[model samples]
Target chain A: MKPDSPFLDLETAPRVAVSIDGAPLELPEGANLAAALLAAGVTVFRHTPVSGAPRGPFCMMGACFDCLVDIDGFTRQACMIEVSQGLRIIRPRDLGADDVDA
Target chain B: MSTHDLIVIGAGPAGMATASKAADLGLTVAVLDEQPRAGGQVYRDVDRVAALRGDILGADYTQGATLTAGLHHQAIEHVPGATVWAIEDGFRVSYTRAGRGAQIAADRILLATGALERPMPLPGWTLPGVMTAGAGQILLKQSGVLAKSAALVGCGPLLYLIAAQMVRAGTPPVAMIETQTRSDLIEAARHVGGALRGWPYMLKGLKMLAEITRAKVPRYPGATEIRIEGTDTAEAVSFVHRGRAHRIACRTVFLHHGVVPNTQAARSLGVSHRWHAGQSCFAPRLDVWGQSDVTGVFIAGDGAGIGGAKAAELAGRLAALKVAEESGRLSTDERDRQAAPLRSAHARELAARPFLDRAYPPFAGALAPEDATVICRCEEVTAGDIRGHARLGCLGPNQAKAFSRAGMGPCQGRYCGLTVTSLLAAANGTSHDETGYYRIRPPLKPVTLGELATLEHSAPDTAE
Candidate 1:
């Protein structure tokens, strides 16, 4: 039996407004901050010094800290950290070697 | 701690065989597992198979089932649903049972933790109706529930096995889409030729495929664009083959990119590993004896590599022989002689692997899902975000995480890390393993913040 899709039919995914590194962005309600950031055009969530590389969520789960970002000065996994209205995220400095322009 | 001669960490064929052999040698042995019943994943109790009588579980697993029952009679302590978290010095095992934590130690540790089905993500992959081929089997095994109408996607022996299982369950699938190319099958045939030494087992796989065809399930070869659609939950999937679009309407979709090694425990022990390109997963490097770089810890079965049950059982027996020899229980010559049969069986079993690998190469397009496609369902990151970060010349997965927060989700990169790594590796012109997804440290699953807070209250602080 074919059942209606909750995502398509009811759009059950909640909506949340998020700000990445002080930049305001609206995202799906209940979306994790990293996901909300990706949806809101905030791709470069943080920077790494060792190789000046772009990093994002690797293990969607907390086992991999690859998706850590600054949410109000606290380091957290974007996957694990749920997004909420008016959530303020801070982007760290020295994110990448290429970030000289930023 | 009650001392045992052997502590087998699973009750599948590998663990059972290891415990049985060690017991036969008159060594005290105990087998620990997390399943209510033994047989592990392969022999998971499929309700469909159970209804058809036990033999439907497949003879290989049925034998394992029998062996496990026999092991119980030998008085091996079988711990089910015990989440083993650590293996300390002197083979001390720390595990959590129910709501409390406990520890045990053994003379030798045999890790046959087995394998998990590799996750292959696509758009709408996180939807409710989509599930792994293994998960589908589990539902059938435990609940006797069928998908009513389902679509089976992906390739290799599991594809055929699942098809035959679905048929036997009285819920014939609507279609089966194979990603294997025709050339792959020809190559696989050559590989299968060498494995014909184990021809009886090979024929069983063939029989399953034949049954699927007779069931009138349309088979699509070299199928790409496999997708589950419907929006919130999956309703149907459409794929293109030979420049034609074929859509199947089904409530459930079962996908298998093949098996991946269960390396969390091994990695935690600091055992070095290399990413297997052909298998597209990470596996520990074990010598012929399944000994990791660590002196005493041995790994066997699918945890070493995916070679099916026969190969795994033989590997387990061989691993035990090596341990016996190392512990000075067996002479060198005697060990070699005792292991010869298993080694020969291993050679035969592995003969078909190259062909299987060729027949079941991961769909490159599928591997690198579209930028908008959801890579991390828990965090909802996309391939585009990963690629956009890669464009900034981020060299590795760690840096990618800094730039896009891709791997930092609730699932902790379990689902998306590999996918994102491949995408970033390609865009930055690096090897996938070089970018290495994430080094998994244990307590692999999430422990509630409250639970972790209480650990300090109970355990004596041994840090000093």
Candidate 2:
């Protein structure tokens, strides 16, 4: 991607291609799910139901729960969740009404 | 079934005074504090160590025992080491005690939770031996342990108090760097004239100044930079005042720019906050009676603003009186009389805070630690990481967190979120609060993995 921009030193940390939201994406070693998503410019982490307002990371820890997104098949704090190759991120609405966890 | 008509969330001057007044009205009042004893931070047992060596830190802390004992006699259940996590709707409080979760319900809630020392960042602040002045004082008072030799810095009344306390302890400070200028010291004398009715306090301030003068601790006013140097532990600190460099060869550094309202829990509850330009932090917006916009929830003491202990106590009693009026327990005349002292004290505190804040606004360099310094100790992310992400056009804290994992930690960014956000704002040349902290959500404390597993899975068709 643009000859690595001379920014990310992939030699220090290996590069890995991880699937997010079922889409293949390449990330570096030791990169967290939240950071990888942000580096790729996927800022809108989730959306609220009633008003359908877009929401993203706040507090960036498991404390806020603002960065919660459905990964693989379960809803979890994206800040706490780390990135791995071939992982899936599902949207809240896509999880269906009955399967939601509050 | 131990129930109370009202539950106050601190036993400091504010909580004690409020409980006293509330108990006088025949309401069962319960006070909870994280400390094993009352008196909060201000009246902590600092001087008792002096008594061990036969010196007078003063009688103010000792006199507080009467107020605490009086509350105890009023049938008030003072639960110590009770960390309140959240105040739910209908006044249900979920808290942790002795490492177990517990719940209690109350008719009315007063948060007199007092203030926490504002986090002032400097190079090597994350080092082991460098601590907030509050932490050092607490250690000395609570455990009879000193911080070995120390270099105390920052500008505030507490600096003078701690300096005096250190002198009395027979181990005077190696160096004391003041951020306030000689002009501010002169202004303090002038400001105390109108507040001379509290002559005892004015005299105390004078006596402290005299001690500083006599000790010749080399007061450096308008201190700009504080450089704490060490690896894994603090070895020494260096600062610049005027145009000269002053360094202290000491093992410990006690620092506090000023106090700020502890609004972490309050803000997470969606209780709106007003940015107090004076304190440079957002404090809970409260009316004269300390009633927040959230109905049935009241804030008092330093939570409303950084008034000292005296004003905090007055605010607590006044808030209770206001609550008494709203609950039909007091008439308008009674309410006015009860709140008179608080109104006056609040005015005085407000008048003094602006001058105090401006006199020592975080010495530009103290705004954020160097880019190489670790901003988030939990994730071990440095300021460089945050800056790198910012260069890639990451707009906000959330975006930066995604790129650097700076705010992701067990402490949950409570310690680092504000710092990282401030750094982001500065690097991007934006407003400070514009790069506001990460949003707070539910499960305020770290819930166990077993507990999460225990929560029943949502049904497939359920709406919530």
Best by lDDT: 1
- Regions of model 1 farther than 4 Å from truth: A1-102, B46-56, B73-75, B187-192, B402-410, B448-464
lDDT of 2 by residue, B190-231 (tens): 555444555555567779979877887777778776787875
TM accuracy, model 2: 0.73
What fraction of the real A-B contacts shows up in model 1?
0.04
- Model 1 chain B: weakest 10-residue lDDT segment is B450-459
lDDT of 1 by residue, B1-464 (tens): 56676778877778877777766655667777765457676765322244343443455544545556657646477777565666776787766555456667776788997877676777666554566777666545433345566788888788788788778756788888888898877766766665566576567777998899888889998888877787534579889999999888886677877877777778777778888887887789888899998878888889898887778788888877877776677889998998888888788878767766777877666688887787765556688988888888887777877777665654556667678778888898888767876665666544444443334333244334
Candidate 2 regions with alpha-carbon error over 4 angstroms: A1-102, B45-55, B181-203, B349-351, B428-433, B447-464
Q: Over the stretch A20-65, how does candidate 2's per-residue lDDT look in tens digits?
A: 5666677655444554554454545665442343444433323334
In candidate 1, position B126 carries an lDDT of: 57
Tens-place lDDT digits, model 1, residues A1-102:
112311111113566666765666666664445434433434344544433333444333234354567776556666555557887876655435345755
Candidate 1 RMSD computed on C-alpha atoms after optimal superposition onto the true structure: 10.4
lDDT score, candidate 1, position A25: 64
